[model samples]
Target: MIEIAVSALLGAVLGTWPMYQHDPARTGRTSPSLVYTNQPNVVWKTYIPGSPSVPIAGADSSVYVVTQGGYLHKIHAQTGTLIWSFPIGGACWGIPALNPQEDTVYCTWAYDKKRWWQGHVYSVRSSSGSQNWEIILPGGGSWTGNHLAVDQTGVLYVVDCSNPDGMVNAINPDGTFKWSVPVPDVGGEEDLFALSVDEARAHLITGGWNSERRVICLSTSDGSHLWSVWTGSATGISACVDPSSGTVYHPGSDGILRAISSDGNPIWSANLSVVSTPALSRDGSMIYCPGSNAFYAVNSTDGSVAWSKPIGSSSSPAVDGNGNVIVPSSDGHLYLLSGSSGNTLWDVLVTANPLSHIACAGWEDRIWIFVTANDTVYGLSALPVEAKENLPEGFGVEFKSAGKSIYLFMPNDAQVSLAIYDAPGRLVQRLYDGVLSSGGHTFNPTLEAKGVYMAVLRYQGGMKSLKVIR
Candidate 1:
């Protein structure tokens, strides 16, 4: 096993490039995949038509994003090409839900006319940019809540806040009504919170305060209230349900993180100033939550603090396949930390004020990072470990070790620094720190310790390292 792992690592260093392959016809992903890695293969990026500020939704190898201009775009996941786009003729607030089984995509749209707000739900075919059916929702007010949840059978549950008659409705794949239930506190000013479907439990979960229960679980089949529980005074915090463990984790508005059983029983509550939805590890071991100016890694089993690191104001963190947690901060850097110890592995500067959550896809060594800045969408790939010394027609450095001496090649006259560290990141020697001419240089630092070491070349906004045996 040890030999196999080492062989794999060496193979990665030799640039075993994974092919760019994906099937957009695959079923929609209800949640992110368990496979994520530091190896980001940024395939492509394209500017969307309108402002797509919300998180992008995916299913069947296609990404669906609705712009505030009410235009729904179907994009190819692999190539970032616009497969098709359709105008909604109103405003789109949140993400769209895709139903692969029905070959349909569902979204909410609203428009104001003559002092009355009109809301409509549209179902479009996923394969072609064709409208299937449109259903007018029951709401006279102007604001349509950005809540849309779907089940396995293509049944969609949506929320409509229309004055004193707020409602939750169940719509079938054919745009016919299944049922409708009244929502509490219809005329209040609270945000319409999130809606999630627990398919295994056959329940719809959401948070509220004006209702009989703070947290309510309704029947997904008929929009009937199943059971409700109030965790605390906090409202509008979304709940994430773990099917395998049958546990729901949600953040409280009053600086509390509460874990509840599927049966509405409290499992554990931790008082942390959580601000975003918690992300669960693929193995259900740890939960990563973002707080104000910090990110916390908590044990999923007992809500205990595993590790915490101070980042700038950040969006929700994401877990990659290699157990590395990804946190995008307001400081224009995306921080990748070791999942086990919360140690910083690499932090790459992306764009300024990246408050939107990063979307990750693919498996194993080919994971891709999809991020949207203020107006542009960026596709970022993980840095390859292989040594490709072809220096892109600019200032660069290459490190080579032969016998007891180290050979360094600099492309231009630039300031450079060399350092040696052990396998565990302990500094062993500080060799040189000064300007070197654009030529080859040699340094023979005595190896006082008998272990594996790394030689680093730092110069001009870039750095490269090579592993050496002493």
Candidate 2:
């Protein structure tokens, strides 16, 4: 009877041990598949009227979008549902900027009143869609159709085209005027068009409107003049700041993208035809931008093209947390490219003109893409794949032999195992039996006879077999 009880206890322990060996909660997180170039799985698409500008200000799993028909919309980044919309009595040609901490959105609009284009700015609560404040520009002029930029401290900056000499204004969050600075008067023939802001250094950068195109940086704190540089003649310039390094990246009408230091010194620049504003990688090691007819990745430190692909004219590229780039193109398709190589990994076709700038947020272990067109928005889901061949997910691996030991290097973490089989098809040894992290792992093969061996790696819902000659 004592022996029977001991055997029963041993069986119970074995049954429960398997349960605890690989708890689904610990190792069964739904990781991305490892299939090469998996196609984009569109979650949902909602149609809207009129072409839409880029969606912006993603926070708490939602994206705020604006349309050309004076409509402001809040979309669920994961589900593509329209949570709310507010009409501002004009065309919203630019994207909305959100102050997530303050739960407020700042946007600009233009309406034709009495044959004149009237421009106005409005601040609305992000949660309730209530108008917090409104500021109308003085003496409505022809709207140049530019975007409003917000600084770190919640100040809004915009260009006032109504003045013969374009003016830049800084307003407090509550709609009170802080300061305004007049742009140097260009000949009446010149027109100013786009604006960007650097909040850390309190500088405002504006581009477009002259035979000699330029980017002027102005102080946001007091509207003081900082620095300005001429970027040969061009139009449709866009600029953005690297959130990690505070470096300013601006694409010029001249088809050149430049990186400027915080103090306004040129770090590096690249020539491209109609490039979009640079989208920074999460690690800040690379910048993704749209070329004239392709997407390109450039090294952030020196502005060198690391990779380029023919993906057609694109909206501003969005970099996901896993270092994948989601690019929307005029061809009516969203392409996912490998961030390191600009290789086409996947593509999903949508309605025509789905080229609005893409915005991404991490939700429920998936990266969500918000695409806008004709007043509609679509959400796309992307999950990371598993590591391949001992390499980390989304990376490569290599093996080298040194004397009696083998050194293996993987770019990412992976499940790996090794076994030795004799000519009689009998298992001789078991080398390893668990998952390995990214980087190098070393093992001694000296104990095995000088014969053929096998290494097996199971990952990404697949398996790979490698033959080793000992």
Candidate 3:
């Protein structure tokens, strides 16, 4: 018999959200095999200069954040410490992608040269923030938002709108071109081109500003035009490719969530008021969508509406393996919705004023939800989505483990008492008992014996407890 701890089982697969919305397919969830158990805490909110993009989680749990100023920063995920920073170029940029096999990061930066935007993609070493190689984007285009993607084979797919045309360029790992396909009705100075690649089916999907073909499927191998489809929506949209079935779930501007096969066939369209990319479940059983003033969870099989909650509209949401939806709303609140009931289990205010650019990534038991506001990056957490599911609203409690101490966090000020009790209900030690202020507080109390203990926290709103296995 294999005696594996829950923590060990949770980390069976490396929990790395190395790109925006989790992966190149924009699924916005961690590995389908992972199950998170750590109590999500307000780990750390570090400030970085320039307009920061949503960070990518490296396989080692280190976060890589690139700013619009063309600077790359490596942050310690658990402590939110700035490990290193590398400047690419002082120009606007987009979310970066990670090539896991090569331990390399691919990011795009754009600069206006004589009123024309010239773009360059750089390959940086993930560990030391050193440049491996870089190549100028052909025809001079700007890459922004979710326009960048990388597959398992280290092939980079990016949308390049060079003046009068929008073309998807495939770049090899060695700073060479594989192929570039022209996407009609998508060429613009600043068009929103959503690029996603499904490696299993060898399909690459692109959508943006093209009423003629709202979605185009291409070959991931050699950039062949496989198929294209026109959804009713005219504006740009993104498609979430399901790894299990190669089903493409696209949320269009027409407020409909449509499921299309990789072969460019429409499976079904469900009107759920969704306008962002859908976050498919780990099991591919549900599609979570962020709509206007509400969040929708639809049954994946028949497009039946499972449940909906009025959580307000949000940036495209990211889900954990447990299906807990992490929504960074336009109102500057990052919410975690229950997978089953579509209810708000936890929420945090990332900023006061949202210029409307927010995204999140999940890694292991701890999920990293970040918002880039006012040229600064703010990263936050989820309170044990699986372990502490019954935590009430408003009075949320989060905790973290430092070197030799466990830090208890309070979302707001409250009269709190936290103590450690042995497995037999004997009081071991009192860590803290006072008016706890907002933010994290150290609890390095004398915990002599180690087996199973309970950290009970009593506060004004209510009492919450955590099981601690020392």
Candidate 4:
């Protein structure tokens, strides 16, 4: 039996990243079997004026993004060409959350420069950028780093701020209100964290950054109050939730990182401040934080700084499957740092303005990490490391992750069985069980669960598997 893995890291489904930072957990992790520490190759780029939010992928790795100019643009991630644009009705600074079922993407925006104070969240077709529906937010607005998020259940979580009080609203797939929980004791002005969930426990989390510095948790099932904690006196951006343990790693307003237990008690606090949010490694043992002039890797358990490398940016860090950190910096450079030693692998200037938004997509062997800076979107790809084994001769899987699709092929038309299984080895779906043709064949299997999975292909001779993280 031969073992196989794609891009090493897994998370974010087959490819269309519907969530803000790679899914409901907001883990900021990517599966790229190989990414160079040295400057990566810029596969493609396009100019999208008016400060585009980080791009989300649609079918076939096509890109969907909302611009501050009040337009939703769909561009091909591979060629960087414009597909279509839909009027969003206002300026947008928040990332768009995708509801793949309805072919819709959700975004919050204000008609003018007043920010989200006069905000509304609308759904647009990921295919044509056509408006599906709009919902006027109860409160004024929510800001950049901590925006709306969607869980695997297809429920959208958004923070509506009327500050010093705010409401966390959960919306159904049809855009109907499910439940809204209020975050009280918000003294005054507030910048809340992005909505994230510990899906296993049905917990939804958000927090305030300003005068109302608190991390609030609510039940996803009924909007019941779970727990709320004082985040800090300082301002912060986002929180990383570990669903398995129900732990939350919050970088509060003051920039210090704190670990809170599932029961709402603080476990440990670390001296880490991030410009945007923290990126947890796949194993949950380390957190990658991007600070104003450097990046830090902290031990998740004891709050110890494992390593720090210089990089100026106020954006979230992304960890590839290989455990390499990709940092898009305001210093006008995209840096690659070793997640372990914090050694500089490579850096390249992409924009003169702040590179604050980053996203990832894939097409076969090329996995592109994208970032927006100076009204431009840059797509980067790394070279394959020497250690990875090539696919079995005449048999392979072409992963079009951005589309949640896979292409499998064999040298000869042979009896092959391909199925999708969760990490626990339970069958999710039986994609095919017959003689497969030699040419690459496409299979579209909808993933319902949010966790690590494997798309295993077997024949009478042997078995091969590829990791599929949604």
Candidate 5:
């Protein structure tokens, strides 16, 4: 009797071995793919004066936008309702950085008057249209661009305009000066147009507008100088630091992307053939940058070409949670590309000219994208579930069993297995196990009863299930 019991236990273990030995390379289910090949679903478009150069920030389903018209407008991200608007003294030409912890946003703007440059920094409350703090810089030169950086502690870093002797100032959360660090005079106008922070190293990276193309790594803790590296020319828009690798991606006016190590050494560089700005991916795996006629994606690890698709002249690209890339092009349309393969997912035409700076925000189930041509703002429903998955890849699957053969065809490589059950859920048979590459797969179903069977295919990054008719 003991021998029989031991044999039964052994059989049980063997019978469920396939399930226990299931392949660990299963892929998660991804939403369907979509390409916006139609006119924009235009949520709302507003008008602004002059070419705008600022990004929109969203908090709690509300989007806050600043425009060159000296207007700060708060709108509903879903319905584009005008919640509130604040008018500043100068043209708002920079992206607004939000500090949700303090319920405030920091923005910068500049105005010109008879050879003088005037700039101001404003801290506005997120709850109500109220000003928390506002500071105006001295009349040295005009602030041509926006360079704002905020730390985790809510300290603001900003660079003053065209003044050769201008410096970067740090403001506390309450709008008090923490410290000010003067940028060493570069002989010409000090055009510190862009800046980034390295939280781990406690350093800040600032670039654009110097006699020589260079990036200054400043000590964030004490506002002291750590190091600076010269690239070539200061023509790029922003600099991004890869925390995992401690490398800086700087796009220069010379139309080249240079990778500088944490120690200020050159790692690799690539030319995009056109002046453009660089934007890093959330996962740090890819870098999307605008080229002359096409936007390009480079593998962040080794700076290799991943993919490039035509989109006309464009600005920095924004990536969404579902890996959709949105970029505003001179063609008067916003192009959305698949993050994985650089495939054109969608395009929404707004105006004849789109703003160089497009602000994008993503939330629970929606995405908000803003364009600043004629002050037009659009809030598009995140593409529908079916629209998101309209990839060229095969979609549906069917399973069948006749005589003694089971057949299947899946889009990608998957671990194909069979589970059999009767009307009462009694265990029957598992026809096959292991991985199945792309295309059709077949297995012998000799022991599979004609009642019912379920075939499941699991692949890296996705999975699919099919019901088999026997």
Candidate 6:
């Protein structure tokens, strides 16, 4: 049996980890593939001031979004109510990153004023719209493909392109500078895009947008230079790192994808010509690359084409619980495709204008997907909300998580007892034991072990159990 580790971190990060084995030689993709074949219905929708350039992040009871209007808005996940809005007084073209352990969200913004370029790295409290720490980044260049990344250690990394020559900044969770590395110039311009962190390997990998367009790696501990490999033409968007294998996958502007080891050794390079970042399967065996007008699934080990299909303009692809490939295209539509065969399962028009990348949240049979198009943000349900009606009558319990808290919802009040047990049926702790009222209940359990456990709830003479990861 595959022992899946549970965590308080919700959505993609929690679902993808150890469940998918990291085999550098594993050419096969997901087995017992989960695919969504029907068009998902939109559950909720909201409007923003400007277009969103980054993927939306959902945590706790809120969804965090950043708009080009220089506004960061936190909205209720179940409802489209606005929680709070924070202004950066500039353009935010990048996505916001969340560190569940730190309980903070990190984002970047840039604006021009007077004779200098102004840029900032904002670290804000995830629960509240309050600032934890903010630091001004150097340079004053346009924000194109710049990405902000945070590791499990709460160390934040960002590429500042405020000047013609870009630079990388490493900052602490408290918003202090750790180290800064100058991006080497190529030709007459130099910019960086697509940043990722391999926390276990203590390495930061990023790609360049100009000059020889190199893929560079730096030491995360001290920001020291490590190795730089020249990828032909431009390095596209960002790269994906497999911490288990110390492998890095980079997309190229010249329609090629390169795989390099942590030591800067070349593994293999394939023709992808993708401009955006590529998505890796949970097991790190398959790579999904999106080009100007097509999508390709390639073998992670040899870069051989698994399958290719015409998908039109789209951002990076996201895989759902059923192993279904979700792609949001520039044509104002979202398509669900078969993960193993690249066959279209469903197509739904999600927005009127183009779309930013997609973000998702999932728990068991339910999946929530969020996408931003033009000035509108739409939420879709892979398994419609009405499906909940199928639950048996009586007291019902559902599990949800974000950050470091696990939420439990009880439909009706009754005498209840809650406890957690390890995979071996060893009771870890008793969370609650008493009469409770109806509505949502939350438990902030201290689960430090990185493994699977069971949550057992007994109420109203009925018992339900859930498998939880910490």
Better of 4 and 5 by lDDT: 4
After TM-score superposition, what is the CA distance of residue 259 in candidate 1 from its true location, in Å?
A: 1.6
Compare candidates 1 and 6 on lDDT and give the better one: 6
Q: Score every model by TM-score.
A: 0.68, 0.68, 0.72, 0.78, 0.68, 0.74
Residue range 117-176, candidate 3, lDDT tens digits: 777888988878899998877765554334577775678887776656667788888888
Worst ten-residue run, lDDT, model 4? 1-10
Ranking by TM-score: 4, 6, 3, 5, 2, 1
User: What ordering of candidates by lDDT runs from best to worst?
Assistant: 4, 3, 6, 1, 2, 5
Q: Across residues 138-202, which tens digit of lDDT does each residue of candidate 2 receive? A: 53474543556655356776666654566677888889989866666531223645555543344
Model 6, which residues run further than 4 Å from truth? 1-39, 138-145, 162-165, 186-190, 200-212, 363-366, 384-388, 392-470
Better of 1 and 4 by lDDT: 4
Model 5: per-residue Cα lDDT at residue 369 = 56
Candidate 5: worst 10 consecutive residues by lDDT? 17-26
Clash totals, every prediction: 9, 14, 1, 14, 27, 13
Top TM-score hit: 4
Runs of candidate 5 exceeding 4 Å displacement: 1-40, 49-53, 111-113, 138-145, 187-192, 201-210, 363-365, 383-470
Residues 213-245, model 4: lDDT tens digits: 567778888888877786544543557786556
Output the worst ten-in-a-row residue range by lDDT, candidate 2.
Answer: 13-22
What is the lDDT of every predicted structure here? 0.60, 0.58, 0.66, 0.67, 0.56, 0.62
Better of 1 and 2 by lDDT: 1
For model 1, the stretches where C-alpha displacement exceeds 4 angstroms are 1-34, 41-44, 55-61, 139-142, 186-191, 200-213, 232-234, 363-366, 382-470
